[model samples]
Target: MSPEEKPGGPPPPPPQAGRCRGARPQQQQQQPRRGGLLSEIRTAIRSEPFHLRYRLSPGRELGRGKFAVVKKCIQKDTEKEFAAKFMRKRRKGQDCRMEIIHEIAVLELAQCNPWVINLHEVYETATEMILVLEYAAGGEIFDQCVAEREEAFKEKDVKRLMKQILEGVSFLHRNNVVHLDLKPQNILLTSKSPLGDIKIVDFGLSRIMKSSEELREIMGTPEYVAPEILSYDPISTATDMWSIGVLAYVMLTGISPFLGDDKQETFLNISQMNVSYSGEDFDLISESAVDFIKTLLVKKPEDRATAEECLQHPWLEQSDEPISRAWNESAGGESSDVTQQDADSASEKSVDAEKTEEDESIVTEELIVVASYTLGQCRQSEKEKATEQKAISKRFKFEEPLLQEIPGEFIY
Candidate 1:
């Protein structure tokens, strides 16, 4: 079988015209792959082009965030379109060099991940940093669900998305990069359709860390922040898993499970780990779906399922083969953790009926917001809180309202 025929891999390009057909088809030799693709990537990095190679289109803004704007640009000779992300070099009188460099390093490390945004080249102006990225015509997945107009997405679509997300995050973990902020808004699509490939974006809040290191900064959106983050505990890869659980909940229920009317209430919910998959909406979802979500939302970071484990769950597989809750600890627990495809292994362990109860935690329709969550009435004066929140309302500077997912052709 040809290399291109390997299961799940993309097909090879068609033969070019005027190219020698070589000998008879039966005598043609299959091309050998050497040094994998890492060597090729290293070569590309050595000769990456500069800003002068591209012609910026007439100031057509594609998207915008707090301190940057993404524009659509075209190559000078090839006219190939690419996304040029321009981030300011300074913010709040502080030099943004460290943060920008960290982000770039993380992106570079994650370049080999297909589901991760591909960074083509980098450039700099006196006051800005420009990243030439593979353009994802599809907007944020949050907006995609809104365009459906029904609030939530179907389980099948969720399966595809979850697979890509797990694969991408697993890749990050393997590279020691932690995406501190992962939400529906940060997940993008390659096109404006359900079938558009998944593209995780916005690494401004991401960090690269060694396995033994941990970060304690309070980061990420209140609604999706992990319980540990709220408690000011050390951050790890599992911290990102918590946000993945919340993201799954939002995609499945069209509701922000932890979002409250105010910041205090939201933080209270997260701190308490107040999450549930109850209610009528969950009735139609398979039991496996709840298992996948619950395993990632654990209060103990160590207990949360790794990205490798999430890929093994039945919900993401969506296979007709008889699914088993039994796991092969020896085999399943060992992996490079680079991608779902590389991490998966069929378990030979038989289900132990004694452990069945462990799988039946919660799967209901009406997800109840934990009322026992501790934060009481606002301790600070309402006026002071209001003043602090005034600037936050303008935090996400998108070209259009965030949740308005209009799926028409994305006119460049």
Candidate 2:
């Protein structure tokens, strides 16, 4: 059964053909929401928009974060299933509400994008803000890397997924929004299908630039942050391209181009632009992929390719055979053949992870989780609020203030 049918709302108009395109399977007619786990969620969402409560029953908990928990949820209304994310208030001293608002605002800004996660709705109670969202059950690309262990993604699959991601990033850049944080964990799969349709999520660190110039915000994951951003130089859509380069590296090699056992080591390697590629791993990758990554990870942000430019790179333009040979025989290893100036710049990146740590934008944490919500909670709250508003209007009255039209009484 479809969730709309079960929610007992009017049959949902078919999703815009271009937007959904057979994304979800059609199901039988669903009965409306009865008293069940879904019903309980609806009540909890209504009472307090924070602190999500759910009954996963048989399904195990996939993961948990400081602010949200992802559990399997099935829609009783339509018998459709989803991953319900329960988001709670931030721990004491954390401004969770504000963070949720930022994420919602960013998602709303990117709502029409197919490559980005779609937020269904948002409602709030005194304690929590319920956000019902379209679930991406296929999970994160990070999981894909973990599963591969040492072997990276198949090159063809990497290109297919990269094309989709490029489209998504292109859409974001067109809107002047720079996703400051771009990593595997944030890229989600709508389905575990062969094509690997992706949806970009988590906008807690996004920035909307006002012009074509570099921005001066110190933000982004260390492994992917551009050197210019670290120097407080400036950032733009190009900064995101740098991260994409790193992403491409991971997709093709299974290991990050610049990795360290600890943050300091990672920062040191990134600062020096120190990177390596095993002969076997390099053989498995294509020249175009390697070239594309090299072009973006350049020390000079200006020289680094922009997302749009990357789409037109010769690597992306070549056939698989030719591209594969470039990596196996031509492109130089840890020592790139870019230029003397670029080499010099890479050598002098002020490997100062210490200074970076002191920057206010640096948040030394494994993960930062914010608001989450279930569809049931949002629907139930709207119903309850409507009912309360009706009763309040009928019973409440307001006395108007007494008129004081008399001129300032001099001697009245």
Candidate 3:
């Protein structure tokens, strides 16, 4: 398989392209003299006649997707490295220049935020646009998810990473933007050995939410998609929270909560809110972490925890100290001090249990809505099948008489 087609590995270096002649002095004018998609793109991105290769040295391909390939590039002047993403203006014979422009706009909107990947510059060619973006050398956090047991992240590490993710997401929500796609693959790290900070990338599926408008689209990775998305409900900031919940689950257990054998089954699992906290997968995990996941995985978008709330959760707010072992060691015998601490812990547990029960009740109520929605879908599918069957029957009946009218030898 080609390097671009290969999955889950460091991409090889991209081949060098031919250099073009420099733009004339008159053509170097910064004004958007041209009209159409180029003009629209110029409104958000600075377009220059000079080629990107003129100022930057292209290196290895960092990653590749459906319509874009990111390659490592170094600035000739500053010697700084950047990820240059090359995106096609057209996909499947359809003009999608506007979609690329929208992504540029979203990046520009969140440019000031440090957690989101920064866009350095943009260059346009005849058929493709190149975006020089801040390079995150650590690669995707997804690698850690599937890493060997010894290389997996501890609970405290998960807390730190989650906190940064929540901060970035909160910034986006505050700006009235929703990153429809929030998965491990889109999240990058600045360093790998010490585990650097999170840099959320890929705004290709993000959208700006307006109070006067309702945005709805069936987009995003199926494993991380929310119930509202499957139901065709209006999109909101809560949509991103659901993905965060799924992300947290994966980081904690290295397993997806609602994934099934196939896409249809996976969709059904998400639509029906089919998730579990089995002991096998979550036994070593803390209760606070489980509670945080439960809070955000609610089927009702309105009930899911927001980014701000998630940041404030006890799990994320826990101290960075080593995991405590006093409670576990006390299994043999308890001193007066340990006994008192146990009483206090039990009291806190009681309160937490009460809150958990309330949350469970709320989820139970939401399950009714989910069941109704699923039933309606099944009914619709049955109706469509019956209608198709009737059409086929009518056609067969009409054709049977025509066959009878023909000679037996001709029919044979």
Candidate 4:
């Protein structure tokens, strides 16, 4: 059989166009054999103008999703690294294209603001739509805080990041946009120093709200989801505010105020604002910061502080005096006790050096493609697995409004 009909790899290249339709003369018997055809076929595929138009730069896969892959890519023309999302076309009966279109359209509309990850460009081929977006190097605020475990950022650092997040949300709200999902994962850092610079990313679930309309969709990560969202009530900027509070709580204490082993349990805990903070680990957190969290975690969406209001809150105010004086005396300096131990033992110092190297490697990799997670790579079971693995549990007494799921009739 002709190599063109072969089943493996790409089909062999078709014969060149200059052959006669009818059988050629005896001179045609001198035609080339098809054994060398595979190279030609591969060349054609690679040489297609569509493929030649862009070079896929080297970037480790940041994340894998069910329908797409998030890769860190640099635009050859601009030399600026961006997150390139490669989404495969749906098979016979699926309509993922529409979902992609919606995300792109919403992002395009919202890209006017600096807080949103700018959707730089969208390119389509027969099989995929490539979405290029700005890359935030410092990685997800979620991972950063979680990595801190017992010792996340101090109260002032938390306040600084929270204020910036609030400002970003306020900007979106003023533009009549609602980022239905506002968790720590969507918050990113552009800088890594003590003073962090943040930018909001991931608009996969963002929606533009009409001035007169209120949304009633239950979207967003469960822990940070607002009360109204769980109840199916109309959502507004308040929903985002609730999420901000959850983020603040997590960043300061390395523990969520809402505890649940699963989505159902987590939702329940969030509804009641049931929470516990480990003083042993979070001694550095200030009372004002904790109070702000209590106010925002109130089950009633109407009672929750708005982003603008949050910015005006006294706890968020800038002060020259250190809020945590202990931090001033102890934060990140040469400790004689620790140094003495390291110096006294060669093995101990070597181990410390190795750990530092590993940590630095992790940070370097994480900074390059923080936006590589695409929804297509996510599997239902895998998502459930992640939830199970990160399960947190505890309960606390509450004396305020409790969240309840809204009935369908009143949800909108």
Candidate 5:
């Protein structure tokens, strides 16, 4: 199922046809009989035709969304693999090409950041715009969250991934861009068996935050959204920090901090700041990890730690000795006076062996089953809530100013 659609959620409202307010006479005359407006919009955007440079693989869909579908594609000349994200030019009888264009522009601006996904090029057709993006073979980090206990990320692993995520967020904040959405699904890994570097993807909801203006919008996956978002308050970089806190909690415990039985309940939980760190959910988690989450999950946005601050938190700075020693104790291994560096190297070697064993034991079918169960348990409610949230967003009429023209530097 598409991320936008939940198993039991209501279908999206149908489109209501409408006419554009302004159009040049000559352009209207040149418009074709069908999909004319979209064609003109595509021309103005100036993208190369997708079919000319790349060939999409049949039955190789990467993902799907309300107005977009991602498929695996290969560049003809270089035979390089890429994920082609085809976004519809129009949605619900309104021109949404600009939103796709905005995402492209954000990607362009973030091209220099190693943590962010690289956009190779763009392509356009009458009805769709395609983004050629770097492909991450390891898939979503969400998978690891749902993996078996033995295969799930340990404290040390989560620290490494969280640091990278923070680095990416810091880079975006430095660029004055706020990635409103920052959940596990959007964070991809380059490799899976031994894990790999982070590649942050899905910038469709991201916005350029200007200091002179307060950007406020009710758009994000419900479970990971900040309290300010629920209150319809001004959004800041702290909003993303709130999500990072929730993400860290989920990564460590595989349980959402504020999720409830339903959308209304979820919102209420967030509004009231209802959360728990007791019981078996956090039994194996470290106090420093819990403290790290607490520091960011504060009700007040300003009180939350900034991305840079989060990088320097004690939880992230904790050396490998404690975790390694704990692991040794748990596994009934003998303790020795090993140096921190030696401990980390031993821990890495041990984790790698475990990973290899786990990879060999877990079959693809079991993974699919685990993934399906995890999605049903964790993401179904999130998807249902997200669909309703999108509908509620329409009532706000939160429109961003359309860009007059694509910047020359941003053009691919």
Candidate 6:
């Protein structure tokens, strides 16, 4: 199911977002969420009335949400390409113009960072909202993470991703925007020239906080969510840093550190802040990098390093030099030449097909148990919220998910 097809809100289940494959099996048709950032901008664009800006030749559906759909659009006059994210103006008997305003405000505020997605133009109708945006061609980085490669990503690759994420997220923090949801699906990669560069996206669950305010909300996916969120306590910028730690762990090891067999267990692990790098997974990983993750994964948000402090960490600032070739070769390194040495059955891949089911983005078989548990929890929570609340709040709603947690694209 695509994010749009899901009832709870857009799930950020990133499709196999590599270059937007032209042919997709009917069962594999769910495309990436252009993740929720694309839909966020579209929802935001509907806030204002504008002249017919451009003719939209909708291509493949980039992302989906309850009320929005993002597609590749082209400028009628100049023939330039852009993402046209369409959204309904009203839903559940409520006028959502205010929602559009909020989305645009965040997009404009975060535009200064190159790693953030750009809102290009806006158009509106009585029933729909259309937003033109800078297209992200490479798609999400999830496919590679789940690939059969002996390694998910090298230390150098992880550093590259984390550095860009930290820099961009730092910018968001400086501006007071708290990205309540930070996960792979919400993170997209640029096309061609910059290839694998990271783009921090999906503002659906993000909030702009007052310097003195204590932001608190039951938002964010299970695995990547900060413990503070679990307790329904106040939130801070550190919430995002916690997610970064989870992201770093997954990127480097292709496995989630704190995930468990059920929501209760997953939440239990998070509450305990228990993580392991002692396994074979960390044997090849650097102590400095592990230390970096440990610093961010602390039980107390105050104990977690700030984004700026993370940038200063030796693992991120110094020579990446890549984790040893043996590690990369085992995990699946950048060098195609090395992949040839592997057994025929284990061809070097960006994602391990065996682990993921068709378009379902769960990264590894090891993750299925934990990931499925999170999904079950998210669904139950969604149902509970629906029946319990007079009206469901979009705050807890996923920006884009085909599943819950990580739409959470295997892990939010």
Candidate 3 lDDT by residue in tens digits, 33-55: 12111112223354765343434
Select the stronger candidate by lDDT from 4 and 5: 5
TM-score winner among the candidates?
Answer: 5
lDDT of 4 by residue, 121-186 (tens): 677777777777777776666555544222335566777788778766776665455666666666
The C-alpha RMSD of each candidate to the native structure, in angstroms, is: 17.4, 21.5, 18.9, 19.0, 14.5, 14.7
Sort all candidates by TM-score, best to worst.
5, 6, 3, 1, 4, 2
Off by over 4 Å in 1: 1-52, 56-60, 150-152, 320-412
**Model 4: residue 89 alpha-carbon error in angstroms:** 5.2
**What is the alpha-carbon RMSD of candidate 4 to the true structure?**
19.0
Better of 5 and 6 by TM-score: 5
lDDT values for all models: 0.58, 0.53, 0.62, 0.54, 0.64, 0.60
Instruction: Give the per-residue Cα lDDT of candidate 6 at 65.
Output: 58
Judge candidate 6 at residue 110 and give its lDDT: 56
Q: lDDT rank, highest first?
A: 5, 3, 6, 1, 4, 2
* lDDT tens digits by residue: candidate 6, 154-201: 678778888889877876776556787787666777753344788776
Find the 10 residues in a row with the least total lDDT in model 2: 403-412
**Relative to the unseen true structure, what is the C-alpha lDDT of residue 111 in candidate 1, on a scale of 0 to 100?**
53
In candidate 1, what are the lDDT values of residues 168-208, reduced to their tens digit?
A: 88766655567877876678789764468788877776655
Lowest lDDT 10-residue stretch of candidate 5: 394-403
**What is the Cα-based TM-score of model 2?**
0.62
Q: Indicate the worst ten consecutive residues by lDDT in candidate 4.
A: 35-44
Summed backbone clashes in each candidate are 8, 9, 1, 10, 0, 26
- What 10-residue stretch in candidate 1 is worst by lDDT? 403-412
